[model samples]
Target: MSIAIKGGNIFQNSRPFFDEKMKFPSLEELTIINLRGIAELWHLANVEDEFPAFPNSENPGDSDALFNNKVALPAIKHIKMSLVDGLQKIWGSHLDVRSFNELESLDIKFVEKATKAFSLDAIQRIRNLKELNLQQFQLTGQFIERVGFYNDEVENSVLLPQLRNLKLDSFPQLKRIPWRELTLQNLRCLQISEIHDLTYLFPASICKRLVNLEALRVYDCHKMKEIVREELGDANTVEVKVVFPHLNFLRLSNLPAFQSLGSDNVILEFPSIKEVDFDKFQNPILWDLLQKLKPVKELQLGRCESLFELHDLKGRSSTMLPRLRNLTLSYMDNLQRIPWMIFPIKNLRYLKISYIHGLKFLFTASMCSEGFAQLEEIHIQDCKDIEQMLAQESIEDTSNNAAPITVVLPRVKIIKLYYLRSLRSFSSENYEALEFPSLEEVEIKEYDKEYFDLNTVIKKRCTTRLCYAR
Candidate 1:
């Protein structure tokens, strides 16, 4: 049977919702769109053996509600509640998953009431659950600290064995999620948003246990300080590397207090990640940890006010970002320069740098011929101090008195330059010829002074797109 209560006054009496002769043995899906009394559903699903276990069930007259409760819904699978304002909670502890044998998905929203103490123990027995989502359920404290919240009583237990996806959003009072305590073997994706009090997202134990998690996203968590908490170690023990084994997509945004994700005490590894995004600020360790990541394809660091430069990628190191294709550096006010050799991405396809005021140059002429072999596109905008694309002293032969230099970017096809007040030439010397045989389109807009001649450098087949302030 399927039930969807659109908008109607709930029956006020304590009679059965369905006729006894209707034979509605189990439900496949149930949706509650708005407020309606649902105490009867709980009363019907409750069992006398379950009620007797709760001391509060012995109340003076409340037991009368369940005296004839033998409605069996042993096969209910999907349930979603959009706004059940009249129904405080479905089942606190009076009902457990002992009745929801085939339940697979549960989603609830706007569970707000002033007097009820809701416990989530009702869902633990649902061993077949694959997805669980709770939104705007302003729970302030723990109801069952161990089984539902921390440890389950089921011995040799792998809690929520089939659960694959979990999401928790808008719980302002939640300080932590018991990822370390949950022995879930199949959880694959997790998203937590608008939880203002969580100080850290992962414990060291979770990094060791959650080998199947693929994507993790956390946003609008105002008080979060770190993505992973370093496990406290014994004074004299060895710390092995902790790997997220399968995590491929990671996004951390709008977290002002974020610091190191791993501890100074343990080595961390992400061998399978393909893309990483930081929408706002980040800590120094995030940049430091990138050294250990596997080959990533796309990376974007946007509006990161705390980041000054790509300082860690410099110097001689065995680190390689071999699979990087698209790289964007945006709104970073303090980034100083881009040294192409610092990046080992020889086949890099696209690069963009925008609104970075402190940036001065993209590369030195001497390194340009040795780097960016298979590049296709380049874009630079709103960088006021960028005087040249390549540094001239990098290739000028001072010992030979003077000589003409030709800089080659063989596979370059598209380039855009905008709002650069200080650019004088592609190279420091105004006479050097910059060659782009495969150039297709070029855009130069709103520069305070004309620096490079489009006709002289690009082939006649290339088209220049232009827009000037005047």
Candidate 2:
């Protein structure tokens, strides 16, 4: 039932205090609509020119007490004051709001001129304050360099220990995260967005301090090259615990200079980490880190063009993922082939390979290779040289019993093939013959269809549906 008015005007006029007081005594709400687009107002100037002192009054008129004169509203739970500037000196020094204690929320908007120093004396006075949002405010750490603004410059580093959510945006000048002084025992979510000059916030050693932090996002910070950099390169020696153990989702994107996940110098272990998404890392280092970290169900590596070979099992390379269920490798221009020799996993259910312009083979295994029994779904798209899933070779009857024609499909159910311009044929009989008994469906998607007669072949040989789409 309450309404608000905007763009209205209220002129500066002096009046006897007793005249209008009795007229509007019983009025519940009074809105002094200011239509004037005046930007600057001072307490002394308003008191001297607008409202002069009473003829024989002994007490001086209080400019800061002006907000107290508004009509009282017992039902008012929220108040929004806009277009008010230079409020730093007004509330920072002498505002008294003990009577408005019942008010739970206050929103101050478009006050860009307010100094960051003003909050030191003002915020602590609001005893019942639960939530606060500072938008487009010119706040800086140097603003409260002394006098324990929040407490000490050390005390100034105060976190709403009770606060559960916080959002800070477009603050390019914010240089440091006061993690040392701020107490965030109950903080659950934090977002820092669009800050370009933020070179560093939390030191590598302090990532363990945010114990209760569940979700954190640091996005579009162009200047920050790494999260925990010093301990990440190939040569450091430190013990870095997986900071944010309770974190379930983490996104590090568009950071062009991001090199590796962690410093090789440190023994970094992510015991509780389940998801990681990173782009533009050297292949050797990327795989090395993957070998060191714990098993995650899903992993995505993008735009690492330098990765020519998946695993150099020829030397000290690691084994295949035992816990991976879905793996996607895309846009790896130099990847010549996937070295399945090092893979120790026979449990992979779904695998997708795409846009590896140079990728030649899915594995070095012959079609009759029994080592790949657990593979169920294979999706190959946009690969330039790979024309087929497996080569066909007829097996001669060598068993003791009479020849039994049977396809063994213990797991595979779906297969997809697409966009191999150079793919003249899928699995020609020239190579070793292969057999799949569990495969039930095959989908071929591409711009050219005549070169691949997958539908006719699947219907006659595999006895499965071969869906072709251009």
Candidate 3:
């Protein structure tokens, strides 16, 4: 039920890979890789006599009439093709629809010369397709329109009605995606990357149609200005509320022109989102969006040059990020320190910081005395100005009774420090050693031993494995 062909020039003379006389009743999966000089895949010798269901009709009715009884590969479910440079067409114009009616998944990658994957008529017949991935193709707007509906007025007409997952990547010439013309209610995952000419993603009319979308990731789009474009209708038009009820994972990275999701006329909501990643983003609007993401558990921010601090956290209540367990900050040269007062430290388990040039220390001595009860891992690397892990400070008291307190890290198990040239000690000179009841392993690389001693940082009775490199 499976056929695989790789690295061959067998069908080079404008011939079909599957001849008209061939009939495959039980073939289910087909994979072709690194094939050269292949012009076409399927062939039908007689177009009028063999398949006569939709001869003169513009709109085909009754899905059963599209399939021919004698069609080859009648039960095929999956097809994948990669690195087929010379392939011009997937199938002939008059090929029988039964060969692809049962197909569920189709993936094509690195087929640069092929302008389109399937003929307009052939794509509409594959009603059972659930997943489609096209990468490194030279397709344009015409290819997208060909796969979509030919006539919008056709009653109850939709293209790829059963498709659930769709990915389009590295299409440089593609400038627009006609979301309003396509019906994609069943789509769950949509990812688009490296489409340089695209200026915006979704128009206002297409938001309600993507009700089932769970994951949306757009990366490396240099010109994208908004995820959803604001449309101004007549004065009678009511306010628009854009909501993704089931979406949980969202990542937008390396988008320089992106400013906001939508304008003032639109209300944005992501009720089920749990994870968010933002990198190389420079906009104050991002802070407004983060204030609404109270349910996000894992957050990663990197290379945001304009960010000097968490400006929104300065005056807000401590209830922000109540569920956050993992946090990563990297390549932020202007950031001075972590705003510990805004973080819900009891729920934080993992903390990673790297390439932060301006930060001097991670926590204050008073902060360490409170203990990170649930913190499990600490990783710090490539920080040029960091002098210590904790800064020496006395606990604030109103009646002039301030006192130095003992540092307690009750649950921390692993500590990793690398390439921190300015780091002198774990804490300032006041605390000779810190309590590490659950410490198991410590790793230090490229650190100066003359400035700080390992014996002065940890208690001698604590049995901990230490790994040190030059």
TM of each candidate vs. truth: 0.71, 0.60, 0.80
Q: Write the per-residue lDDT of candidate 2 for residues 174-237, one digit (tens) a residue.
A: 6764555545666666666666776544566666666666665666677765555443444546
Please identify which of the two predictions, 1 or 2, would achieve the higher lDDT against the true structure.
Answer: 1
Error of 1 at 284 (Å): 2.9
Candidate whose TM-score is highest: 3
Provide the lowest-lDDT 10-residue window in model 1. 53-62
- Whichever of 1 and 2 has more TM-score, that candidate is 1
Error of 2 at 11 (Å): 14
Checking candidate 1 for backbone clashes, the offending pairs are: 146-151
Question: Using lDDT as the measure, what is the rank order of every candidate, best first?
Answer: 3, 1, 2
The deviation in Å at residue 447 for candidate 2 is 4.7
Q: What ranking emerges by TM-score with the best candidate at the front?
A: 3, 1, 2
Global lDDT of each model? 0.66, 0.50, 0.72
**Tens digits of lDDT, candidate 3, 1-470:** 99898885543343324433457888999998987655445544444454332322222222212123345778999999898755655643454755788999989888665545555566567789899898887763355324434465333456688989989888888787756545689999999999888878887778888899899999999898878766663342466789888888888889888877765566778888888888888747667657767788888888977666565556773666678888888998888877676667778899999999999988876666554678999999999899888775543332354444457788888888888878888876644235677887777777777786778787635444444533
**lDDT by residue for model 1 (1-470), tens:** 89786654344343424323222356788787774444323543333343232122212122222112344566679978776544544445545333667879889887664123234455456678899898887765552334345333434445577889998888777776755435666889999999998887777766767889898888989888766656563352567577888888888788776765655566777888888777786635556645666467777778876554445546643465677787888887766765455566576788888888888778755676776778899999999888778665533355555666778888889999988778766765553456777888989898644565655445548787767733
